[model samples]
Target chain A: MSLDKEKIKHVAKLARISVDEAKVDSLTKDLNSIFKFIEQLNELNTDKVEPLTSILNQSLRSRKDEISDGKIREKILKNSPKKNEEFFVVPKVVE
Target chain B: MSNITNQSLSEILKSIKSKKISSLELTQEYIKNIENAKKLNAFVTTTFDKALENAKKFDNKPNNEQLLSGIPLAVKDLFCTENVKTTAGSNILNNFVPSYESTVTKNLWNNGAFLLGKLNCDEFAMGSSNETSFFGNVINPIGDHLVPGGSSGGSSSALAADLTPATIGTDTGGSIRQPASFTGTVGLKPTYGLCSRWGIVAFASSLDQAGPMTKTVNDCSIMLEAMSGFDDKDSTSINKKKESYSKNLKDNIKGLKIGIPKEYRVDNMPKEIDELWEKGKKILKDLGAQLIDISLPHTKYALPTYYIVAPAEASSNLARYDGVRYGYRSQKGKDLIEMYENTRSEGFGDEVKRRILIGTYVLSSGYYDAYYLKAQKVRQLIKKDFDDSFTKVDAILTPSTPSSAFKIGEKTNDPVSMYLNDIFTVPVNLAGLPALSLPAGLDKQGYPLGLQLIGKALDEQKILNIGYAFEKNCGYKNEIKKWWS
Candidate 1:
């Protein structure tokens, strides 16, 4: 299946990536090639294969599980673009 | 120790303790080398001033006996260093500076390690060849013409170029091993969750692991000792009591059952690489390690499985970046959504955008089960192959990459060919096991060949020991590549 402009837009939106209209056709072709390769995996009989999450069969080791992030507000906020009184500010959303 | 190129952490620390070398000098030297180097392209953003500032504190610290004290170490661009231009090798976050530090880098900094700089990487750690980085591709330090194996290309090149004593690299699909093999340095992708992923820009969260890339196995051990531990912030971080990753170094390799996976030794293999594998096996056998033939039949499907799973996760994780939040905002926008689209479109390079599209498509609701779920199931089969073999052998061995490093532009136009670079290394990642690449020997053309050792989950020490032992014997006439300079 080929990727139409609409589908490209859809996928781009899902990924939060903005796509330029100029190269939509090229992206469609390359993505189709990749999908075609992925489609080859369907030929194998994976009916018996079990889905694995972590490679280790062992359970995660338990922890004390306490909230202990040492407060470093100044250090933590050093990277924020716009912060006001311990919170990040963004464009107003709700009407 | 003056060069810091091939020096071990212990030696560097000793030099520092004796006042023969100061931390500032080490940090400055690496910065100078990085600036002077022609084409290693190892660093993305440098913290030269901060590194020098931090180095001053090393003078007052107690004799804590930390492995990394006063040593200069590079960090992959994917890992966040607070207030540094912590790009994930993508332009979407080109302006993004992390408010906090990655646990591994934080730990490294805490142990008095000088942060040399941020190394270049594949955009969001997606590509194995370093071609996809928003910053121009990283070149192999050993030879400017070759592709520095990546997405940890910068890390390997940094160590290979002697830019830093060691650097931290994350491996999702052989990012570390492939580059290490290409550049003739040591790289490790420790067992999943051995190092915390918090503040490390996520790629495939399940498969991604932060590891060490150094000039030698011992240096890797020293850096690994500093990096691995449990962090409560990252849900996947293992809570196990930390073991000294260096304890197994220089440990005995006698009677160690090493498995040669028959599946990895299939046809279509390059002849020189095949000969190198045979040579690697012989070397191990001579070192008193027992070689056992084993099978991992599901190897062929590993790349496809990895591609699907990694991108699927990547699609979700990367969705956080948009113009609305604290990233690059598009100047021309009729609306917020258009701003996001234009900003991201302008920010990400062609390769980055390509994978983002592919990733989003596979994980989209209608296709999730067909692509992602099936890939996860196949991931299990691949893991089972490793698990079944581990029972018969203490450690498994294979060719790290199908062949030695290819030319820079060889696979750039062909995405499929680039993905195959990680063919041998991806399987172990899917299985979440600790694996390392040792510079086994040289090929006919004087290029390096690597032998990968896969150990049991959390068994980093054993692999370190085996690597340390084998490295001592490679009779490496010249460890440093003459062409590097």
Candidate 2:
């Protein structure tokens, strides 16, 4: 259950968060302790138990799939860190 | 005018309705108090001018039929306020302003409550203490340098400081109730689907719920009535007619069965908290309510289960914060992948990063079954424990927090110790049930302690009535001296 520095780096990469090399050791230690504590769940016998997702008993309600509201593209793009006429600008995805 | 801020939301509503005090005058008084009490760091952004304008508007056309009727409230920064800077106490969203309002805050404004300011909170409503907020730590008004119990730390601190007559906070894990318990205020986390999660800054989607933080239990009822309803925008919102919690609030609980769960008496619990629970039981007994011993067998596993489930969901929800959409962007990255990594690392605080990492690891390819899926199954068992207990008793009683507010920097290095603060409060969120924390007694250090009443899903009225009766007979008053001012 313990996380080493490499495993910490791997997980951080998967999570899209960068881990500094100097801080990775401490991060590994903290993650190891947390996972060790989380390992306590293994004591329970949940073979027949259902994995509860939503607490409500009813099914998800549906709505008519139609145009509800639109034409406010400026408001949608207002908060973007970098945006052009109609879309958010990210670093070049395709070389 | 000087003592106008001391009145509860319910009391102030009556004054406004009777035209004894204009809304503009009340707004000015709260503005002065907030200005004088800046040292507590309760507010992240103050909207004094806008609030005054709205109050004046209310005065020109006084509406007595509305619930809030021009009362100014300071809500936790976790809620999205349209065109207002809603940071969720994180640097990542330090500059992001929402184009739309959160459904809960929108409901408040529709009822005549105006925004005084956005209050500080644990980043993404993550921490048990206010220490993790990127804005800074909110000092508890109870004593100098004491931490306000958080995610709703700013809400509780502001309410106790009388900066805001009432406030709202979100609870995921122990965000609202723990802070309310620490600051000697009232906080309730309603049934999960009761309040729509439309515009809230997502932490854990399934567990996050918005509720009221106020000076009295009665105020909690009034604010909860205004804040909750069915919303078509939120798929999980319960589509039922709204119940009038404030109007139907009756304190008569004669012969009602209240359960005292045996599992809540954790080992090495401080002597005073246990005594406070005993005193709460005695008071309920004297009020003609029957107290019974009950068992919630999976209680011990609640905190561990929460750690797994909340982080797993948080990781998925927070993935939306990648650099391009509207938050902090890192200048160091060369490519798209590096941009996301650098933006997140530079923007998020250590605790948030830690949770995200834990979530990523647990939901990764190999470990899903062992950690994430297992925790979900364990969550069902935890909910079953409450369901079994509710069949025997009308509601359950427990201490809100294991201990009173700790000093700043006390448990920052020890994440496990910090997570343990929500021991009694986390199970209710896991079960999607309603719970309330009201100050019942104080520790030897004069710090306030709270007793929580756990209710069945959508049964907020039952717990509100129980809390109402308890508030009348408890005789515990919060003696918070305005030391920061």
TM-score of the second chain, each candidate in turn, equals 0.96, 0.99
| TM-score of each predicted structure versus truth | 0.93, 0.99
What's model 2's lDDT at B332?
Answer: 85
lDDT of 2 by residue, B1-485 (tens): 56878988999999899988999999999999999899999999999989999999999998889999979999999989999999999999999999999999999999999999999999999998899999999999998779999889999999999999999999999899999999999999999999999999999999999999998989999999999999999999999999999999999989999999999999899999999999999999999999999999999999999999999999999999987889899988889999999999999999999999999888999999999999999999999999999999999999999999999999999899999999999999999999999999989999999999999999999999999999999998888788876
- Stretches > 4 Å off in candidate 2: none
Clashing pairs in 1: B128-B150
Worst 10 residues of 2 chain B by lDDT: B1-10
What C-alpha lDDT, on a 0 to 100 scale, does residue B147 get in candidate 1?
A: 82
Candidates, DockQ: 0.49, 0.88
Error of 2 at B250 (Å): 0.7
lDDT of 1 by residue, B222-258 (tens): 8888888989788778778878766657757999999
Interface C-alpha root-mean-square deviation, candidates in order: 2.5, 0.8
Q: Best candidate per DockQ, number?
A: 2
